[model samples]
Target chain A: MSELTLKANIDRPDDFYADLLAAHEGLPKAQSDALNARLILVLANQVGDREVLKDALAAAKQAMHRDPARS
Target chain B: MTKIFETPLYPYERSADQDAAEPVRHPVVVIGAGPIGLAAAIDLARHDVPVVILDENDKVSWGSRAICFAKRPLEILDRLGCGQEMVDKGVQWNLGKVFFGDRKVYDFNLLPEEGHHRPAFINLQQYYFEEYLVNRARALEAEGKPIDLRGGSKVTAVEAKDDGVLLTVETPDGPYRIAADWVIACDGAGSPVRSMMGLDFVGRVFEDNFLIADVVMEAGFPTERWFWFDPPFNKGQSALLHKQPDNVWRIDLQLGWDIDKEKEKKPENVIPRLKAMLGEDAKFELEWVSIYTFQCRRMEKFRHGRVIFAGDAAHQVSPFGARGANSGLQDTDNLIWKLKLVMEGKAPETLLDSYDAERVHAADENILNSSRSTDFITPKSDQSRIFRDAVLDLAEHFEFARPIVNSGRLSVPATYDGSPLNGPDVAGMPDRTRPGAPAVDAPIGNGWLLSRLGDRFQLMTIDADAPDRIDVEGIEVERLELSTNDDPSGALAERYLGDAQAGIYLMRPDQHVAARWTKFNEAELRSAVNTATGALSNRVETPD
Candidate 1:
């Protein structure tokens, strides 16, 4: 019973994906990992709600372990 | 191609003061004849104050510098009597486009509201700006207004005393001494006057260099500000493009720290960069080239006993926001009025402290904004760069992220909120005309509101009753009566009165709101004026 918005919010996900990939180009593995870490922190700060962040963490952890072939 | 800079506009001449045995004393002596000094002298002379200006150079600045002039400064120039010519010759535009990588993320219009007289901004060379100011000074001098512009007169030393300051000025002939009751230092960032008095600015120095190339070209690009972040040509740096008058385009390319400063300025190295930005077939001629690294810093206080500092001498900001000259103009706009009042003995000397307070507040705001823009352009760390790129990436399609992208918040007049000079504010009136805010311009009949308010203390009444004039302890406060019917467009009422039916406002000479009320009250009005002119120490007491 949280007020966090969990839905397909992005209008054009493909364009955003391309931009994200382009931003990570010409970087080493360590730098790219650093970038992802920074990006997560930035987006988390933008979200700002502790309840929403907790929900997002739980959802992302669950997605990491789900079976791809069965789903 | 000889330009205005080559001709000596105010060359060295022998003066009578040099031969006198005793040092000649003047009412006010201004150091540095740049935009700020010239403006201060002109404003003082316009008010019948005798002033003198000293500068090392005899002509306008050499190259096209400080291209962007904001509307507020243009309005200030109007009060100085040179705004129309500047607006006529300047390339006016309000649209600005921002690009990330190669694709444009968003664009913005600075001034969307109508009924204002001046445009949002104009791009003109610094040389032309100084030329226009010098012309105005000459006109004032011809009419026997007390203003002396002494070229090639450089101050070698300064000494402050209990009541005045003595300046040792080195000229082509020899050194001469002059004393003034007050000295204004409009000398730039490396201020000799400040150094002589052992004063320093405390702030940050941005560790990046930008290459400025003013090129003459015939191109069809629209007159708008175009800013790029990590363009393909630059490949990890920011760039800025602006169009100036006389077919000259100003281009700024960010170069990382620890680069060869002199070798990059060579035409051989600069031409290839231009070719890469503009295709090989495109033709252009380089007019001037320079590299600059900026510092965001300001003095602890602008007023130091008898010697006062204005403009770059008091504060310095990065060039991203075009706040340098624009803020300097506002500095003179804020200082001259207070100084005039104090010199006339109508107000106590404490009035000058408000200048230091107000302009220092403005300097901090400018520094904060320009520093943020610099950080966004050149991220200090890899993590910061990642977050910056993330903001840019999300900004391409998302509406919420656009506000986070900072491509230099353009210069606007500072509202002296909580300033010592601010008087009082009513609850129900519009916030735009609140205490300490500059009067919002509105079309009143055939003229503008700002034109009628400034130059003296004013009592502006809109659909309210007030006297024709009031004398506040020998200072005259004229009344400007207006109604919604005066402005057929209704902008005046909308801007001045929101939920209220009528309003009365007390305005300072600088046209900032000193106080406002829903109805006319003489006692409260007198108290507000006293507070604004630094005549009263306590807060305004409202009578029950």
Candidate 2:
């Protein structure tokens, strides 16, 4: 998924995601997506809660739906 | 025996006793007395490990260098018990401003609230930073800890012996050799130690050169990073201004390859550039001016034979993002535990190679990202510059262009993949942790987020009610009640969470998550813990 989309999907503090998106600016789509995926997996695993993981997945999917490349 | 003249083993060579020196042997020999190297020495000495540090220079530099330290390094300084002193001496800036021409385009509030332990970034001169480190080392030495500072001694030859490294040093009087159990080279970019080992410093060098001037100013410039694209003074160039702690403002001018670097930085020529940008009415005294060429290079292997590399000796990133010294400090942080473990005989020497592999990966990733950032900020070719300008222009009017304009990737931590530490994600669950980003708060037990900030390996299990279900090794597990009925604020109960109750989270010493798991089905977590703790694969596992 695109970094911007992946960030929006996760339930992190708004400022956190905003800061992340800001940093991801000017990056290629593939790079953005790879970084997004890496973050999601690591965080979901770190949080160690299936519920949070589900939330992240749903959010990621919804975010993907809003963007063509990510979908 | 007394009448016979003593002869050295290398009959033609000099012995290690020309100058008046102590006969004490150090367990570790750390080359380079920079902040990171000093931090490592102080840490090892405090931990009761004999450490000897050597620096080529007689003393630290007086000028301000490496003006920024990120949260991670500050946290490390905190662990070394000097974080508060650094905070007191350094300027903490939580906001960064970006300008497109004279118009300010982007601004970020690094830490909107004050509850977090650390702000986004701290600005301090490298010299003062080293001063604090030297003081700490001296204090430790005074307290009977064997932290030796051999100033003016430069390592000229490093030969790997069966037991340890035979380090050859050039003293003012003559040459001397010491057999160190292990060696850590933190010498800056022109690392003689790294070169001696024949390690490759691989990366691309940018054509752009910076004419940096540190000046004491009476102007009321805000203490924030201000970047100007197509600045008025140099239309095709870039300018950045930041206020230092001593009321000095650092100005950087991007002079493309065509300009004569040496002549451009001369006071007479540089003064006019400063005047045109800051206005003729502004009064400021120039502290120092120098031309710097930015490049991104990382050593392919941080460890060779019996020696290891840290700091700029291992890798260097473009200064645009302030990742150079920061990354070096992180390298020391990563290597400290392994060094201690190997020295204490708790783990085998083979574990040392992981330090090289893991840190090399981190350095390479940082190098690429920083280089990409430099490319975005200062494009070389006309086409790329046009593209950059077009994006910045589109950002002004188009709602869709905001993300592109405000990309926050520069501050995002470099992520680690290809790491054997990461657990497999079979559930196809969406990942939330960005590469190199900090771990998010989650309920693993009766856990308070910010309180667990220091060096400890935390293992969280899925059986929140009964965390004893999984028998993990070499880590402390904090069981969080992921039950929806128990702690409603549990990670499962979050508005963002859908279905998660049983899993595992492995946290590193720095509180950064190292790996995660759902069940103890595979031996991955156990092995990862072993790896993190410097245990050999065949070594007896720590009892659960």
Candidate 3:
């Protein structure tokens, strides 16, 4: 569903990942979950691509399957 | 201190039941004699229906409440016989400018092309507007078309029966009872009748408060709508400026969620805020000052049993967009004619249901627009603020993003699309006048096309001869013919019929299109009439 051409957007992957984890630091589980949800929606609006958002949603949901082989 | 507006308080007369042996059973009784209520009574009265209008207040609105009158309402009031006077008294303008943080982002001309009777918008104090309506109502009353406008009389109780509604009014003397077949409640947003009937006047109440100040000044500001986001005077809030009659200016300052109401209303506090916006040399006297929270909410149903609601009582929108009073006036416009037809036994009661469906739809639109404007003006969330600012920033240079800069979505007449009362659309006709849209006005002869849409069903024909006359059971339908030279601009024919050569449009009493076709047969016209009046229809005629 994504309009993604499998393009890499972030140049500094480690720093981006570190900052995301840092955003969740010291927060309770519920609050941290809310922060992630808000961030995802905010970024989606920034993307302004419905197909990409839907594809990202399917991909994230698929990753939630937690198959041992895929992991 | 500025003097209060000179509005004469009418004497309250006791109900006829107080003097007579039996209570007067009227056909219709309207509650809360505000602009909408008075308009309803006047309209019904004009339709030869006797109406009793009760109100708690003895005078017009305390201040300039609903200041902007859009074009549609002016047209409706024209039929009620008071449109021209209001237009003459009001300041009419169409240009609006929007700013974002010291940058003039976008400006709009509401009526880009003009051959119409009314302007896009008019700025008149609500009190003055209501006074004009009340005077017109009185004029009709003097002409013997009965409009019992009882001021200082408040309806305290409402009891709905199988046939009609019984009302209990609290006057200076005592509470008296009267029964009417129908009741229209226009008693402001805090409707006693709605509360008494246990309806949820529900919706979102915006946390942001705006200090509304009407100041009298002889300034050089042009008659245009000016909106500012993060203006130099107000650091991070939005503000609005509109010029009204009597050299008065209406300014709205966006105050945050919490503030000391009394302190904010003080002259010392309000004056400095005005000074910051209009510069230090702007000498002005405050005429009226009040604080209001933005509320974009409405009732699910405007009609209940034998009782109905209109105006602020039925729906309330944010002050932005000027939808509140404008939509309310439209509510009455959509209602009165139907009420007349039903009361006269010309149509079935089902005809009234269209008012509920149609106005609820209109109210929903107003709420959606008002809420969006509120969000854009306030932008509670950081990301939304970022997006809004981005639109504003882009709008400064590029034309594409200009529309995203939302100051207010001004009120426009609602089209009753997909309404049960509307007949199925035919091909070749444009969507603007297709069975649900308002009839487009055009310059015909020396008058306007809309001005001729009398209070009856009409078949407007373009480039074709009209039907002789429709003598139906409960309706009077007439035909109006217009040739190519009738409209010099040709916008009317273009919008109403697309590229079609000729057509017939069946319009309802309220000037809403009920049906349209490139060609219509008598049977189809009758079917459309039946459907429009809430009567069941079985006949069908295909367009040639």
**TM-scores for the candidates:** 0.90, 0.75, 0.89
Candidate 2, residue B201: Cα displacement in angstroms equals 1.5
Model 1 spans > 4 angstroms off = A1-71, B538-544
Winner on DockQ between 2 and 3 is 3
Residue-wise lDDT of candidate 1 within B339-409, one digit each (tens)?
98888898888889999999999999999999998998899997778778877877787776777788887
lDDT of 3 by residue, B1-544 (tens): 3333455556687666766555568889999888889999999999879899899888888878899998889999898999998999899887888888788888887864576888878899988888888889889989999888898788888899879998888889988888899999999898999999999978898898899999999999888999999888887899999999999999999989889989999999999999998889998989999998867778888999789999999999998788999999899989988888888788888888999999999999999998998899999896677667766766677676676677889899999888988886777678777787887777877888899896899988888766768866547788887675787788777777687888788888889899887775777787788888887554333455
Flag regions of model 3 displaced more than 4 Å.
A1-71, B1-6, B538-544
What ranking emerges by lDDT with the best candidate at the front?
1, 3, 2
Clashes in model 1: which pairs?
Answer: none
DockQ for all models: 0.13, 0.03, 0.08
Q: Report, for every candidate in turn, its global Cα lDDT versus the true structure.
A: 0.89, 0.68, 0.84
| Among all candidates shown, the one with the greatest DockQ | 1
